[model samples]
Target: MPETTLRTTGIDHLVLYVGDIGRSKKFYLDVLGMSVAHESPRHLFLACGGQGFALFEPRDGASPETDRDLNHVAFSVDAGTYEEIKAHLEAHGLEVTGRRGDDRCIYFRDPDGHRLQLVVPD
Candidate 1:
């Protein structure tokens, strides 16, 4: 550990590259009901829990299919809401593909194959 380090509060934003802007826009903005905070020619910033959830397409020759991050994004939810969200995804024909060891957290993938999770506080 460093004696002095950067004082970070929280994530200001997160950027994810997707295959198509229109398709990812529909999924995050329409399907998941994330409200748009801002937009550009390619970037769409979503208002999520006081932080920015950004989705955009690669415009500078980077391929989203081959040059994207290999990880998942997780969001914390209340117990009841967690259950409700899982059910909601199921209603949309999505399968719960995995779970945490505690079982209070569930995992699934988005339309673009990005893994996402919802967890309840212990």
Candidate 2:
């Protein structure tokens, strides 16, 4: 075995498997305020700040299963804007859960049952 150090940067993109690409795309774009970087019939690329995310439609009729206890995606937001964002999500009919032990985070789920969080850095 060879000993070598592997250096890597931050996440470039994260792909989420969705049953309906169009509905997922609209949720990300309209709710999260992400911009569309690219799109196709089966996939959508959305810009998140400097990084990006992709929505992929599975050919099979099954949707992706996310572990309720551990699987989730979190995005950062300004501390001042935290309350406004939470309120917006609620106004849009999404259930938002405040962190049990922390005051700086909220959890919610997307249309595809993917858990997502909005967090404010201290």
Candidate 3:
């Protein structure tokens, strides 16, 4: 028999079940500036750097609160890009909070109450 093992390539996408897809779409696309890969009434897929993130409406009875585990997810960008992105987000009325070490980051919350962050890699 051939080797039976798990071959991992890389993360294809991260999905978030939000209370409102429209709101999540705006946050991920407009505020965070992720490029849209696909969009539907109930879902939005965005390209974040080389990775991807999908936001969709939660099923009935599903609690969006469970997304607390995903409280934040960040993309690594050039150290110089942080300020630019931060300025853009702020200009659009997004609030940013938190920074530490040589790495600078911006923090904000999505419409469904999920926290997100963007970090500039060292």
Candidate 4:
């Protein structure tokens, strides 16, 4: 008999524990322009295509804080969409942190202080 089991589903959501929920929400919702599925003063969940992402305040005494790193959550856009997204994000006054001229990746940071990168996949 075949083993009875449940196949794992894709990512339900990516939870980002931040120092400030409000600031993180603004960056994801306003800066990145992701639609909000659920939101509150303490937490905010946004739709990222089929998956989702949740931003909330960090728990007490989780870990000692340090400077943000280059490793960040990445989004893949159409290669054609790079210029358009870049222009739109810049117009909103968000600085593109790491820009690769040859390759197609635009990097930035969220308000609660997390790095993010958008790449136009070849």
In angstroms, the error of model 1 at 93 is 2.4
Error of 2 at 18 (Å): 0.8
Q: Which stretches of model 4 miss by more than 4 angstroms?
A: 1-4, 60-70, 78-80, 98-103
Mark the 10 consecutive residues where model 4 has the least summed lDDT: 61-70
Tell me each candidate's TM-score: 0.78, 0.83, 0.77, 0.73
User: Which of the two, 1 or 3, has more lDDT?
Assistant: 1
Clashes of 1: 0
Regions of candidate 3 where Cα sits further than 4 Å from its true position: 1-4, 61-63, 78-81
Candidate maximizing TM-score = 2
The clash count of every prediction, one per candidate, is 0, 0, 0, 0
Determine the C-alpha RMSD for candidate 3 after optimal superposition of all C-alphas. Answer: 3.1
Give residue 53's error in model 4 in angstroms: 0.3
lDDT of each: 0.76, 0.83, 0.75, 0.73
Residue-level lDDT tens digits of model 1 in 18-68: 877777887776556688899997888999778899988888857777335
Stretches of model 1 off by over 4 angstroms after superposition? 1-6, 60-62, 66-68, 79-83, 99-101
lDDT per residue for candidate 3 within 1-122, as digits (tens), equals 57778787999999878887776777777766788999888788898889988887767757676546565777666545666777876887777787645767778767776777777665
**Of the pair 2 and 4, which is ahead by TM-score?**
2
